[model samples]
Target: MPGRIDARLQELGLTLPVAAKPIANYVPTVRTGNLLVVSGQVPMRDGVIAYTGKLGAGVGMDDAQAAAQLCLVNVLAQAKAALDGDLDRVVRVVRLGGFIACLPEFTAMAMAMNGASDLAVAVFGEAGRHARSTIGVPALPGDAAVEVEAIFEVA
Candidate 1:
């Protein structure tokens, strides 16, 4: 039988991709005390950089939103790995940090990040509601349109 969270994911048609290995010195996830910190995850899917380019230059609002959602999926992947596949152990989504790659004049960073926030709520219910910071960046690793990192309080 699938875990409760896994079932929820299924119902939403979301399949968490395998956690991406750290490309540099940092680990993908770090657990300290009751908190798990997942490193920034780009919009990677099926082992490819699924979304790339600056939001205001070429990427549309909807695509950037999807990219944000994908980044959070990777975040959950890391969290699952850190918890030995037990996503139900997640107690709360404490915080989320969103980085949006966009032109200097762009101002819709918050709307783009709403993609991840909406999914978080769908997956964790009230516990997924979290404090968040969203910022516009000139660039990101792999030229991905969006990156999202998370702090999760877990059992």
Candidate 2:
């Protein structure tokens, strides 16, 4: 049996979306030793960017949070792909980096990132907790509302 990730997803009424394909020359994720470094994930589903806009401007805090959730979904999708859909190989979530294109006055970046943090804990248990940086940016490609990257430990 796999880890509790599937159950957790059912509990949350969410399903991990398919991992987004690389837009440029980089891969979606890479593994080296015990670490898996995941590229930044934008809020895309079904090969389409679901939310594309700046936070605190064209997008709201709620929208940013949802986009952040999609980012995590993409992250998990990448992890599952890397582990051959066997989440049992995961060990820990090392770190997460989130970037939001938002208005300078927007002060709820952390709150928006709760989506990612919450999902991590739900899927990876205590190991999901990690050091993170949630920073505001002036703009992002495709005018995306949020972006997230992560590092994970694996067997």
Which candidate's TM-score is highest?
A: 1
Report the number of the highest-lDDT candidate.
Answer: 1
Candidate 2: regions farther than 4 A off: 1-3
Candidate 2 lDDT tens digits, 1-155: 54577667768888877777788999988999989999999888888778887777778878888899889989888988988887767789999999988889988889888888888887778989999999999988787889999999998
TM-score on alpha carbons, each prediction: 0.98, 0.92
Worst 10 residues of 2 by lDDT: 1-10
lDDT score for residue 130 of model 2: 93
Residue 148, model 2, lDDT? 92
Tell me the whole-model lDDT of each prediction, alpha carbons only. Answer: 0.95, 0.86
Model 1 clash pairs are none
